[model samples]
Target: MSEFLSHSHPRVALIGECMIELQQHANGTLKQSFGGDTLNTAVYLSRLLGSAAQVDYVTALGDDSFSDAMCAIWAEEGIGLSRVQRLPGRLPGLYCIQTDAQGERRFLYWRNEAAVRECFTTPAADPILAALPEYDVLYFSGITLAVLGEVGRARLLSTLGDARDRGARVVFDNNYRPRLWRSVDQARQAYRAVMHEVDLALLTEEDEQALFDYADSEAIMSAYRDMGVSEVVIKRGAQSCLVRADNRRYEVPAHPVHNVIDTTAAGDSFSAGYLARRLRGGSPQEAAEAGHRLASLVIQHPGALIPRSVMPA
Candidate 1:
């Protein structure tokens, strides 16, 4: 799915935010971490693919201690940071993750002033936007669109078109957050516009239903196929993920977990593992298995990013 690159290992950019995340423990203590959808995918994809692929995060953050930590962590993961911008006097967003006993989570955000809001609008962004077309793959989510505002969204769409013209594949993750949008219709219009540019679509069925009021997973898959996306993946949290890659559809089940401490980056890591495996010459079925393996372990942890030491060797 997506426009498969001629080269096995290609340069890829994951565009989005990386906020300071605070996870509230049951004891009412807060543990700090950093996570954003595309950033999560970048980290895991780099770790999973290692030398096989080049993964980079595309976002802007403040020149603060928290941003320093984020950069240090990314460097440690071997993720390229050429596209990560540091705006002075501004800081990254902050969010708190609160979990229920069953391991479900609710998030509280305080990110309105995050530096990423100007990621694409800044004067320095011209070079990065121009360079995006040269990458083999560009991955982003609805959250990216939401944070960029209308003008920034238009600029991004123009770059995506330019990238596609150069044969760069566009991968989209439908992480819909209604609160971030002006209205459902606005988000729908934005999603529809970007989906047309997407080649490989990674979707969470629950998110699709929430945003589009789709009757079922089949409906969601049909919509993406109608948009001409060659590959569509429907992730159903602890259930099976439906993959439509290379003109074949496979229902791949998630690994059953006894204890899911947190599920912040479960889907993002799954996308990474899947993409990494596929790029490494694995079939869709094999890639899905790799995705599930990584995601299950991610959910068993407490934050969006887990220790690299705990990752699969």
Candidate 2:
């Protein structure tokens, strides 16, 4: 299953927020963890690619103890924290996850004032914004766009344009949360504008269905294709994923598990594994299989990050 990719270490950055997460179990006991779409992807990407890539997390957080702990966690996962800012007087956001009997989770957020809100416009952000164009890849999500406010989002979109002009690939994940937006029309407009510069897209069927009311996966894929995204992946939990790249479409099946404990980060880990293979010169089909394999293992775990020793060797 091994393939040779470029020997040089590829630099990749995932742009988003990571918050303190409180997961309430069926017995009413709460387990604390850190979870976010882009953060989860960064962790898994670092783990999967090992030294083959340099993965950095781009965001802002407070100088509080919680922020320090999150940084420690990222360092332990081998993610570069140089681009992360520590703003004084601001704290990271806090959220809770409530899951049903089926392990499907619901998030309740209290992150409106997190320091990452000004990740782009703050005085400290000028250097970070300037450094972004140097990276080889930039990854982010819909939630990242929604939480950053209009000004911050505008700055990020502008940064993406500049980064892409410098040959950086923009990777997008559509992790949409309706509650984070002012209205469906506004969300649509924001997504459309940002996606115009996206080179790759990781889309969830349900999120797309809710955000754009697409008739089917093909419509969504076609829309992204028209927007100039060279590659698109559609993830359907416990079902096959649809991958289209270089004028070829691949239908890759997800690995199924009989017992699903916590569904946290399934998509994130999948993205990591897929990118790992792709960066190593594997075909899109091979990457999708790796994604399914890693995600299948992740959903069985209790938290966003599974023990590194327990991961695939």
Model 2 TM-score, 2 decimals: 0.96
C-alpha TM-score for every candidate: 0.97, 0.96
lDDT by residue (1-313, candidate 2, tens digit) is: 2232334688998999999989887788998889788999999889988988999999999999999999999999899999999999999999888877787887789988989888887888989989999998899999999988899999999999999898888889899899999999999999998988988788999999999999999999888898888889999989999999888888998887998988989888888888878887888899899999999999887878888877776
Candidate 2 residue 214 Cα shift, in angstroms, is 0.3
Query: lDDT for every model?
Result: 0.90, 0.89
Candidate 1: tens digits of C-alpha lDDT, residues 21-87:
9999989999888888999999999998888888888999999999999999999999999998899
Q: How does candidate 1 fare on TM-score?
A: 0.97
Lowest summed lDDT over 10 consecutive residues: which window, candidate 1? 1-10
Which pairs of residues collide in candidate 1? Answer: none
Report the Cα RMSD per candidate.
1.4, 2.0
